[model samples]
Target: MSEQSVTYMDLRFHTPAEQKRKRRPKHTRDTEFSEQEVTYSHLKFHIPSEQQKQQTSTSAESTDYPTPTSSWLVTVILGLLCMALLVTAGVLGAKFLQLSHRVRRQNEELIEKQAILGNFTQLQETLKNCTNQRDDLQAQKANFSKVVSRKGEKCSLCSEGWIEHGGKCYHFSEERRTWKKSQEYCSSHNSRLLVIKNKEELDFINRLVCFHWIGLSRGGAATAMKWEDGTAHSTDLFQVKKETPGESCVALNAEGGAIRKCAEEFRYICEKKPS
Candidate 1:
């Protein structure tokens, strides 16, 4: 190998004359230099110092960091957004409570109305029952009045064919019949042979007809007089007249009641109550 020549690089710019002679194109003519450049003739090697590398790394890290003012603005914007979300939630919750209250009130009103309607229905039923009772009472009153009026008319007067006295009627017959036959005929006409309770009735009959069969009679025993209804007769009404010792039948005349034969046929008088 030949002997190597060692050269030192000058840490200085080229001279203007040497630069003009080379006439190299300048790519950074207007740019300012951050560090000084050194040239070595016939060499193409580059190496950075430890101090320079450290400075470049520090600049890059500084560019990534944010400023104090920008960080404060971002924090404030986030806080505002959180506040808006809270307000919206509160409004929605209040609206839900209001809806629930309204629904409960409506339900209460509906229940009250239904109770009132039920009471009204009961009242209507009671009124109908009372009306029915009133009508029934009115009908009973009308029927009672009709019965009273009919009874009064009957007691007031006797029929045209009857003789009236003391709220009673009497029929005098001229046809002759035995006492038993005459009683049978009177019963068929819903009447009875004349019964003289007092002197007034006895005298009234005497005036109408003479020697008619009477209801007075002597019992089967001799001289024991009794009325046709089986009661003993008192001598106060009229003195008894016996044609014989055992005359069981009796007759009435203008004077007094007399005992007569049962087989004898004579006029008769029948007595009856008004219809």
Candidate 2:
């Protein structure tokens, strides 16, 4: 062999110890690179811890405060409610005033009606009084007419069954009676026994054809003659004849007057003033 050929063969073929050392270095480098890749994957796919979730929820709650628009909407609703309450109050007040006015007017009307009723009652009383007065006047007028018709004069001065003479009324009785009885009869008729005031009256009585008892009387023979009225007989008048004892009364006829016992019965004449 040549020396150059021997050196070329030694370079191409390595020893066992040199190849083992180069392979050990390459294996260690591959193992280190695989461990680094596993670490990076774990970091990329990780879940959040309990403390991180709490922090996120707190930040979200902080953003939940009321805004300005919502506050304005609430104010508008409160204003609408106040306006409705004011309108209702105004309507109630007006209705109350109207009712009060109506009640006052009714009271006034009632008072007026009461006044009218009182006035009507007064008028009725006045009418009743006038009616009573008219009735009384009518009765008086009727009485006057009857009196005037009987006498045929403007006014009647005497009653019925009486003769008027010298402003006096006279009545003559046909029946006979005692002197006392005749006087009682005259008294019952509102008159007295015929009395002669003068000779003219005696003459006028004598014209009648009646025997009648007179009012002249005496208690005894010596006593003076007197009339029923207690007046003494005048001497100027016609004298009485035929005197009797004890109590005696005078009687007259057409002829003359005579004294007789009081128990003697005769027709009588009565006299009274005109009505």
Candidate 2 residues 111-228, lDDT tens each? 9999999999998875665456446535644653564476657455666656555667777676899999999999998999988787767765665524579888988878988998
Q: Rate the local accuracy (lDDT) of all candidates.
A: 0.70, 0.73
**TM-scores of the candidates in the order shown:** 0.41, 0.43
Best by TM-score: 2
Q: Candidate 2, residue 9: CA error in Å?
A: 99
After TM-score superposition, the amount by which residue 90's alpha carbon in candidate 2 deviates from its true location, in angstroms, is 99
- Kindly provide the TM-score of model 2 when superposed on the true structure, using C-alpha atoms: 0.43
Candidate 1 local accuracy as lDDT? 0.70
Q: After superposing candidate 2 on the true structure, give the runs of residues whose Cα lies further than 4 Å from its correct spot.
A: 1-154
- Candidate 1 weakest ten by summed lDDT: 1-10
